[model samples]
Target: MTGAADRVYAHLGKWAPLYVWLLVVLIALGRTFYLSVNVSNSLPGKLFLVHKGAMPQLGDMAAFRHAGGGGYEAGALFLKRVVGVSGSIVTAKDAGAGFRDYFVDGRFVGRAKPVSRSGEPLKPGPDGAIPPGHYYMAADHPDSFDSRYAAVGWVAQRQIVGKAYRIF
Candidate 1:
């Protein structure tokens, strides 16, 4: 009986480790980390790796869920830089012809457009100090539809999905 049990256990051991590893990878891909491809040229790089367990911080690329605006679908995952966190100041300056320059903590971040690529009208984002539990997301891309426009607005703390890294 012992010999028979040993044979069964050895047979199971050959495939059990592989099965455990596969399950771990599956769980990590969806809950712990994920890979996303950039369809827009917002902040450079074509591929991004996001760690869902990490907290977002100022100056880091963060992944968040879009609340739907400017032709974007609700719940869509977006990656942008955290330019202004809680208590940071946001200011806008005229850049001529209905365009505006956006600044965070006195540093110029982006220019807000008056219209979208499909000819839809666009509204500039708000100015003044950022509220708690919110962040101003943006980048140096002149055409990025980020927090520089009212369409995207300030990203709420609940909307943040993860911290992202541009992985090319």
Candidate 2:
């Protein structure tokens, strides 16, 4: 009886480390999946998680693909606040003193400069309401490249990855 018990204990000890390593690997994979499909690192400040499969609302920060990066940021993702949603009116007009003011739903939000860093003219999107299945996004940073420029105009629904929520 004692010999049988000793053999059983030896076998269990040999396999314990293997089982522990397997568990560690499984945990790593799970964490990777969570970060890849549900979190975004494109925004400044803190790491955020995106609400996958949920509808984005105005004032929500969202993660989306860069459609207007002109291949410079191919496959790059961006994070910005949703300023205008479907049926929301968005306009860009002169705000006196050579500055352009951006409006959403008839309320002032921020300014849109008329030139890019390379001295190219930055044209604004057509003034009016945002169409269905589209959105307007912006960032708090003054120099952020966002919907203020025509190149990054209205973002279509398909381009949005998910709505972001600060995690840290």
Candidate 3:
């Protein structure tokens, strides 16, 4: 019995590292899967992490692939708040401070300049209303690259990854 106990201990000692490594791998894969299907605003700093599920709604912070027209690199993921959903009226008007104020459903949310930092003209939203199956996204940051510019006018529903909920 003593000899058998010794053999078992020796086997465990030899395989302990392998067991630990396997556990680490499993944990990493689990985390990766979770993050892939989730939204994280913690890239620049640890702000929040949220699960990715269901269609995004108005006022929900969302993650999406950048589908903008020019100057934006392809395959980039962006985080912004959904200010306007389908059928929501969005308008941009000169705010008289060298910026254009953005309004959704007649409520002012934020502002954007008429020119890019590089001196190129930045086009505002269309004169008509927002179309169906589209969203107007924005960030509170003054220099955020969002739907206020012609490059990122309106985000399609299909481009949205998930809605965000603050985790921390």
Candidate 4:
């Protein structure tokens, strides 16, 4: 009911739709830019500047360009553990084809799982070698769609936006 509140509400009402449309356009542009940048994977980081849904596709290369929250989006920045990297050997010890943890340089980093709707497992099979120029990453959560799955297969070194710094 105050003058400032009234002015704010009127301004929002007039441009809410336009603002939303602008956001959509930006997202589309970002997606396109990412697609152009990286030939594989989903957007680098989360889109919309706000993460509020299940894991998104990791194929977007531009999305990964962000190092932390200060880049473009606004959210809690997280450090992604490097479970597997280029030329690293990995093995999934399971018969049914499910998620599993990944190791790098003989150190446990994180687990690999599907982060996309395809639900495909990471390639190279158990005890396989990761090709050069590709970096495999995974989250701490088992259910997290990580490098262990195919939907997000191997994350190219060029697609890596930033190394995990610290949890905010």
Candidate 5:
């Protein structure tokens, strides 16, 4: 080989292990700090950055697995706001059983719709203090299929995939 070609090949060989190690570190970080695309109108942003294995906090955006089949696939991952965290008091007000209003720690969360957009009946979520290792997920959108309905009930800690941050 030419002198320059041999020198270039030698340089690459010297740094080959370092380059491989850098690539491996990058792949690990990519898995830990992952990106998610929000596909629903329940949240404001369309792009989200999730910190995998992070514990979800109240009022934080959380990505969890929806035990689906009601307008969603089985084991669908969802992004929603954590309104009621574990050990938080949740109150449900039902006037003549028309529609129930949910409040967490005296703060208004969201209302449970009597029927879905397709006219399917939706049962209200649990009231009183939230159970341990569970959360009430919801959003401002009235049609959001979250913890307010029986379709997506209480979000357990095991079901939470990660804590999400809206990027866009």
Candidate 6:
């Protein structure tokens, strides 16, 4: 065993470039495979809640894709309910009107569209209709970003990366 180990070491020292090339090739292939799996599986990605982008935005359906950075290492994911879509009209005032009032198209629909909180009917005005392709998502928290922020208002369906099922 000692002799064999010595011979292997001698050969490796003489041909170091070959070993280096092999390592590089392996690394590249590994990275490629990982990326392919991620794209196909929609592998859960991590999102860092930036100070500005911490709050969820409108058009946010599921909570898979994140606004901030941190690729595939984040653990916490946020889930904001969908409130409105594209083309829909939002109104500033009506029933249950809060600080964030919206008007979709020309109608005054409730802010919460598809899903309602506590199984209660959404407020009348202070609402916004969703468009066909676009969605209006918002967090239960009033201060949350959801559709309210000028920066991340109304997320496009095309932009959505994936749907989140679990938090852990």
- Best prediction by TM-score: 1
Candidate 4 regions with alpha-carbon error over 4 angstroms: 1-79, 95-127
**Ranking, TM-score, top scorer first:** 1, 5, 2, 3, 4, 6
What local lDDT does model 4 show for residue 84? 64
Sort by lDDT, best first: 1, 5, 2, 3, 4, 6
Q: Tens-digit lDDT track for model 3 on 16-122? A: 99989967865765543223322343223334344444467888877777875556776677777888888888877878857888888998867888776788777
Query: Who is ahead in lDDT, 1 or 2?
Result: 1
Better of 5 and 6 by TM-score: 5
Error in Å for residue 69 of model 4: 24
Residue pairs with backbone atoms closer than 3 Å in model 5 (clashes): none
Model 6 segments more than 4 A misplaced: 1-61, 64-78, 94-99, 102-129
Error of 2 at 138 (Å): 1.1
Prediction RMSDs, each to the true structure: 9.4, 10.6, 9.7, 11.7, 8.7, 13.9
The stretch of ten residues in a row with the least summed lDDT in candidate 4 is 34-43
- Steric clash pairs (candidate 2): none
- Candidate 2 — which residues are off by over 4 angstroms? 1-44, 70-74, 96-98
Q: Against the true structure, whose lDDT is highest?
A: 1
- Tens-digit per-residue lDDT, 16-106, candidate 5: 9998996786588887877789887988999988889998888899999988756788688899999888788888888455788888899
For candidate 5, the TM-score is 0.78
Worst 10 residues of 2 by lDDT: 33-42
**Reference-based lDDT, each prediction:** 0.89, 0.73, 0.71, 0.46, 0.85, 0.44
Q: How many pairs of residues collide in each model?
A: 0, 0, 0, 17, 0, 26
lDDT of 1 by residue, 103-134 (tens): 99999999887888889999898989899999
Model 3 residue runs over 4 Å out of place are 1-50, 118-120
Error of 1 at 154 (Å): 0.6
